[model samples]
Target: MPVYHSGFHSYVETEALNGALPKEQNSPQHPNLGLFAEQVNNSAFTAPRSENFKAWQYRIRPSVLHCSEPELITQHLIRDIHHKDSVLTPPTQMRWNAREITEEKVDVISSLVTMVYNSVAAVHLYAANSSMDKSYFYSADGDWLYVLEEGALRFKTEMGIIEASVGEIVVIPRGIRYQIELLEDVARGYICESQQAFYLPERGPIGANGLAEERHFLAPDASFENKEGDFSLYAKFQGQLWKMKIPYSPLDVVAWHGNLYPYKYNLKLFSPVNAVLKDHSDPSIFTVLSAPSLSKGTANIDFVIFPPRWVVAEGTFRPPYYHRNIMSEFMGLIQGQYDAKEEGFLKGCSSLHNPMSAHGPDMDVYTKASNEELKPVRYKDTLAFMFESKEPWQVTNFALNSVLRQKDYLTCWQSLETSFKEVVVEK
Candidate 1:
């Protein structure tokens, strides 16, 4: 659902002024409006099956204004390629309780705790008490996928503004400078970083009607802040954070036109395609966004969600079936209880099941779904999601040692007593 279409050749533009946008063409020289034109390229110019994303910007000033020696700053963020040390041997299941930001004040970068990362992708959790003032950030390595679970975040980006609240998502393409402003006093959420550009997954037989309609996908209108003062530009390059002093704010794009822009979508807007008859459909049906891998038909990262929807399948098991998967799954609960996890999987709870790891319903959920009468049951007050990736997720030291980590997560399945009974047939 997230990968709308190939990003190349599609020009999605939002103009804030009449006649402000250059008409009929891009890369105009010596503009009559006296605005500097710049281009941003997100992909290689000559890649096969190229979804090359390029955006033209008209701003009050060019981005070349800031060039200084960057200072390597330290933070809670951790990045690694193979992540061998983070993966626990025998592959244990892990969980974290809801983390409320009631401690010392922290900003976006300061609050980030990267749970897992490779050369291809990284998973992070954040809870911030303050906004970014006179600061901006850009990641040269990958695009960012943000899923806010607790509070709203106002993102002031180079292209425009995109605000994501609880049950919503925003994707900032790699190299787009943006700063966050917490609408609430505190904000908590998950972040997924991909080394490749993310696109709406191919709908295949589902066609264009369901799952993250491109028409519903909206980009911000051109807006810029003309501020001149001491500023800090933070960049994440080669898996390190660097800070540089600048004299002006980076959020200064007055007008822009291109498919290479940030966009926002509410998770509730997704038209879930479920099994009408007897079995649970593949969770791929719930994918909101996907980053495809080099291998065909497989994803580097699939952003899937379990939103509130109807469950009406006669003479069949309703909950998710127990199984092991090749792709590692990292799941988080944004709101109510997950259908498959009856207890202990509270709001803000996070879990990880590595490749080929067995995971399924808790004892209570299995019992209830098996015996309950079949009816059109509406699963309300719930929004759960997963970052299902092709590669196994390696847990960070922070994730393993955090106070929020649950020590007894493995006990949720301990109550599944052996029910294997041999039935003798009477002739």
Candidate 2:
């Protein structure tokens, strides 16, 4: 197991070698141990002090040495929000079964399939069997949020290494070189690439605690590997794949001190907040992270999770209520069953509800919650998450034509019949 330091966006100063970091000042004329000093800025220099993100890395070789003549590569499955192959359809509910793992050797990069996207974010699904070998990848477009559903994965990043399994999530900052290695025979998951950076949601009246505590988010300690061989570095830039040959491993940072690095959080550790007395609170209470837009409360993208929690609301329908909203939602199950649907929605399944497209508990779930006793029930063994955006999502051509799509998804609510009856009272 790899060691990790806890705290979200907290400044971390770690070194694999003693005296590897400079004593004072960020960049010295000569860094300690003869290491090269480089600074990576995630935000503008004029950004607010509280929002500024940057890191100082002391490495064996400067990153400029990794540059080479790039060659264009063809990757039809991976797409951006502006891809011409995407399709826009009328507002409708959609659902899809989990993608099957490939039988042939495939890595995380080759298995990525874009499902839906907008100007704010792109949602993708991946199923792969082989680990990345002598190759690394980075994205110049957006930060990656990985929601692991099936197997374990080891991410070797420029900062350090992080191992994550099902019921966990990992976020890699944009422009960070990393390689994904399968810890199991097969791996399946969902990824949300957001143009904006992710930040913890405000707590408001919930006080200073509850809902994804900052101390639970873990970042890896400093580690490095010095090896020379024929290797390739792939980059996702301008909606296309580019490759360059390199002679050595990119994970050569001996020391780093900064707030901009990859991190991981376990879903089971999320402290969920919900209604305890009479009604269901808005789903915003479940949000783990949000990328804010120019508009005050609206987010470019919100990552929310529905984990195991207690249900104690009285005189109210326990499952989610039927309604419509301005934000679009793309949801996936990481494990077990979601409470909103008694059937059909299974582990690893995905569903989408565009803006103003009404979605709620299915017929069976509604009937059961309405008639069953309202005792204090504890939901267990379930994990589901959603990637919500203010902008509506457009389905990709490949997702629309996939056989796993549920064509009869609308029929799940067709059986809902009117139960209203008028009564007269004597005046």
Candidate 3:
């Protein structure tokens, strides 16, 4: 089992070796134990104190020793929405069935397929059968938020090791070196890459008690591996993949202290806040994390989840109402059925609603909720999530052409009938 310190973004100082971490100063003329000191800055050097994030690592070898001449690699399935060759579809609703895991052995990096993306964020799905061996990867373009949907994964990072299974998530800051090791025969998951760093959303009127508590987020304790061999380093930079041969393992940090490090949070620990007696609360109430954009209230991306919760709304439709919004939404089913969707939507499946695209309960869900008795009920075993963003997501060429794309998804709402009743009133 891996040990973790409790708290979200708290300053953590951990050392794998005794006296490996420097004391009284971030960097000293001669660091303790002859370890090289290196600092990683995630934000502008002069950013606000609260927003600035940096980490100092005391490692046996500097990161510069882990690099060599880079070679370009082909990752055709991975794409950028703003790329010249990216495809833009009309504003519409779309869904895709779960992709079949390949029988051929592949690692996490080789299995990634971009579903949709914008300038600031991208959504990707991956299914891998083999663990990365003597290989490590880091994304210079953005931080990665991993949502495990099936099987388990062990992330060995420069700072420490984090293991996450289904119903959990891991957030790795951009430029953090890590390698994914499979703990199961097969692993499938969703990845949200965002240029903006994810932060806990502020609780205004709801106060500090409800919704993801700070203590539930866990950061790994210091751990290091002293190994040298023929290793490969992969980097996703400027929307392209690059590779390089390294002579030694990069996960050699013996000690580190900082607020910027990879961390994991179990989704089950999320304390959901919702409507109790009236109508359904906006999905924002279920946000687990938000990546803020330049706009004040808007978000570059909001990772929201609809977990099992009590439904006690009276004299109101129990399911989500029909609506359109400015934010583009990419939704995925982790398990069970989404309340607003009766069929077609299944575990591992995904859907997209571009900006201002009308989407809501399907015809079956609407009809059932319309006549159902209004009583307190518990929604059990259901887990759905959405990657909501301020910018519209453009479909990747591979996603648009995938066999998993459900071409008949729009028909689910076609059966909705016009139930308007006009009554004459006394004038």
For this target, which candidate reaches the highest TM-score against the unseen true structure?
A: 3
Query: Any residue pairs clashing in model 1, and if so which?
Result: 2-200, 2-288, 3-199, 3-200, 3-201, 4-200
Shift in Å, residue 381, candidate 1: 0.9
All candidates in order of lDDT, best leading: 3, 2, 1
Task: Give the runs in model 3 whose Cα sits over 4 Å from its true position.
Answer: 81-84
Assess candidate 3 and give its lDDT: 0.91
Give the winner by lDDT.
Answer: 3
Using TM-score as the measure, what is the rank order of every candidate, best first?
A: 3, 2, 1
For model 2, how many clashes?
Answer: 0
After superposition, candidate 1 runs with Cα above 4 Å error: 1-10, 15-20, 48-50, 82-90, 424-427
Which 10 consecutive positions of candidate 1 have the poorest summed lDDT? 1-10
lDDT of 1 by residue, 207-245 (tens): 867887766666776778889999999888877788999
Query: By lDDT, is 1 or 2 better?
Result: 2
Q: Write the per-residue lDDT of candidate 2 for residues 1-427, one digit (tens) a residue.
A: 7889999999999998999988798899989988899998888999987788888999999888865799988855777764647366667899999999968898998888989888878998989999999999999989999999999999999999999999999999989999999999999999999988899999999999999889999999998989899999999887778899999998999999999999999988899989989988999999999999999999999999989999999999889899999999999999888999868889889999999999998888888988999999999978889999999988888878899899999999998888998989899
lDDT for every model?
Answer: 0.82, 0.91, 0.91
TM-scores, all candidates, are 0.93, 0.97, 0.98
